[model samples]
Target: MKWIRKIAGMQSSILGINERNLGFIYPNNARKNYKYADDKYLTKNILHSHQIACPLTYAMIDAIGKIEQAWQATCEWNELVIKPSKGAGGKGIMILKKKNDQWFSQSKPVSEQDIFTHIANIIFGIYSFGDSDVALIEEYIRPHDIFYQIFPEGVPDIRVILLKGVPLMGMLRMPTSRSDGKANLHQGGLGIGIDMKTGRLKEAYDGEKHITCHPDTKHPITGLTLPHWDEIIRMSLKAAMKFPLHYLGVDLVIDQRKGPMVMELNVRPGLGIQLANREGLKDAIYRAKQENLLN
Candidate 1:
């Protein structure tokens, strides 16, 4: 009931309320990277500065001046992840796996020339909002085999929603046929509720209501307790404290060997979290407030 009211309150614009709720809310202008909630480059910078756990970034080429060198730099790590710094919703990301001194992508193999061209396009910002975008070459995480067993050839991540530096609610995002290998809820993936107190997964929702099997893999989506759930929640809260924003959604992936790594921070997290939990995020927010999270 609380979640329903919270979800309903958030959509006040549709509720025919002409009067603004300005006092109870802060305007969105003060938030950094508001337009791009999950900018990979900005997320890395925030994580790195705070010394939070994240995938190591090898190189970041933010301007045309550093583009050529970024291309020529032979990555020490054979397998790497290249993605637009400002990209979100799982677009413009490429994973390069090394085999026998040659580079192979998730879908295709590439040569040195191919890598250079790709970097060039990144410098040109072909895959981003504008020509001013940057490209990040980061450590590629071999996701834990347990999750991979469910969604092989894809990375499954957990999304933790934080309100005022407190872990409020969470969901495990699993890739599905509709998402094309992405675990984003809107992209046809599945969202499974995480018990806030126990950190165990409770149920699964497909951006709407309860669902058991993945639409693509046909795999069951419930009853799997996340590894390092408490640690992950602690890390999410700690990471949020480092940022200036009051409300955010932090995504993380657990690597087989690397543990937990921050994926991205979303300033304007989607309302899908409500449906995923089968409860409103508003109730969690109120609970956190009662615990003095605003302080």
Candidate 2:
């Protein structure tokens, strides 16, 4: 076991060395917060200003406001997502769906008071980096039904990795037992590699190795071609182009009627995308440059 661990560590070091040498042409920063930290607020403000089509922001309640009033004001949206403005990895977030004149949190029945308490908890940063400072109430879009069938009970979204404002790779994240119904791959969800140009699932991998069947569903995660692949890639490039950083990942979700919406951006995206795609990311970015897409 020790030998195996030692060999794995040595291999990782070798990869890290290769990645660093490649950094001259392909930029990467592992220490800084990227789109996930700044993109949500920036996206909310920018998209709202240009009317580029986004989830409607019904309300933004700080931790110290009239929680009940905000809850009442948001009751009519029918379906909505209550998310901490600064939360990451799908923590401190709640989904409210209206059923027969009542709203339920993540499908559990709840009342107006229940929502107030929940939002208040968000303000307290129950699932955030710090105290829940503020929360956003936005339209809860019903994802395309076909994708929903794959994720079941949760929202399965896409993550496109971009370098120098060009889309290089993409993946479809499916909710699994590890992710607790969230599509984030690092949180234990499944990451199925996407073809750079086609957006089709080519291979699937959990955190460790290649996988054909979901750890929980026993269903294969491959063969599902994502809808609106071209548009999703374009949106990712457009969003990344707006930032000063050269490398980033864009999280996008396609709605049933509204098309693709930018969910958030991540500056320091996870590198597991390489394993999911069955290739080294360093090679993909190099290809992107050779084709002169970065300029």
Candidate 3:
């Protein structure tokens, strides 16, 4: 609420999608490098090639026949995340946590048949960009204690915007009960803006309301500092450099044991990130270009 009053006085620096496309996306991103960032499987392979840490892939199912094999291989693990390799906005991601020998998705018990149907839809491009996609079953990361304190139900991830290997802005996304335990802002999750310099919480927004505390957890979201702040930025920048793109959005998650690992890379990252930071991205973009950082 306090930030809302301050927002009026502050000159808006929001970067519109048109400007983003003309100024950053089209000029910076290349068609050749899109595959590495757009496809989750390829992203993992590329990250592994560069020795960058990411969620471990247990198995990949490209067809219906492979689904049974992949599921059997993953059965040994108590928890696993199965998702469309080319999915966007958290669509078709099933997180299975085993309890008392039963698998559950979002705490609801799911049968092997249900999972198979989901994977079938993924292979049919139901969750992808109208193209056939593979299903990637990966190790589910358990976030650190700090994230648990903020929101105990779902995984929280940080999105850092980078320009030519420099981190310009960042935000932390926490899932709410309404989001069905998915850390996506469009799906009722909380977006807390992070100060890029210190990785400290600067502001919080939930799509509709701007607040200081989480609506569900009632935990204060401001002034909280992310663990391994510097490492997060470093890892984001490192991942960005691996791509040929001049601008990128690197999503990083903090594993309880691993510290920081890249979850995904976005060549055309959403502009909603500016809303979380309470700052305009246009200024940062102009600055980067003027400094020749875009080169």
lDDT of 2 by residue, 117-235 (tens): 77888788776666446778888877887676665767788888776677777878877756777787767777788887677787677666677766775766577678888888777
lDDT of 3 at 120: 94
Candidate 3 ranges beyond 4 A from true positions: 1-12, 286-295
lDDT (C-alpha, whole model) for all candidates: 0.72, 0.71, 0.87
Best by TM-score: 3
Compared with the true structure, the alpha-carbon lDDT of candidate 2 equals 0.71
Give the TM-score ranking, best first.
3, 2, 1
Clashes of 2: 7
RMSD of 3: 3.2
Q: Write candidate 1's Cα lDDT for 1-295 as tens digits.
A: 3333444655432211112123222443254445435567776777888888998888888776776677568465778988888776777777888887778876678987777677667667777755556788888888887677677866888888775567877888887757767777767777788887877777777655587666666666577677887788888888777766666788899999978888888775666666678666556666777887754
User: How far out, in Å, is residue 252 in model 2?
Assistant: 0.2
The clash numbers for all candidates, in the given order, read 1, 7, 1
What is the overall TM-score of model 2 with all chains considered together? Answer: 0.84
Angstrom error of the Cα, residue 173, model 3: value is: 0.9
lDDT of 3 by residue, 3-47 (tens): 334444556577766777887788888888888889999899889
- Clashing residue pairs in candidate 3 (N, C-alpha, C atoms within 3 angstroms): 13-280
Rank all candidate structures by their lDDT, best first, as comma-separated numbers. Answer: 3, 1, 2
Q: Model 3: which ten-residue window has the lowest total lDDT?
A: 1-10
- State the lDDT at 31 in candidate 1: 44
Which regions in candidate 1 have their CA more than 4 angstroms from the true location?
Answer: 1-29, 32-39, 63-68, 207-209, 289-295
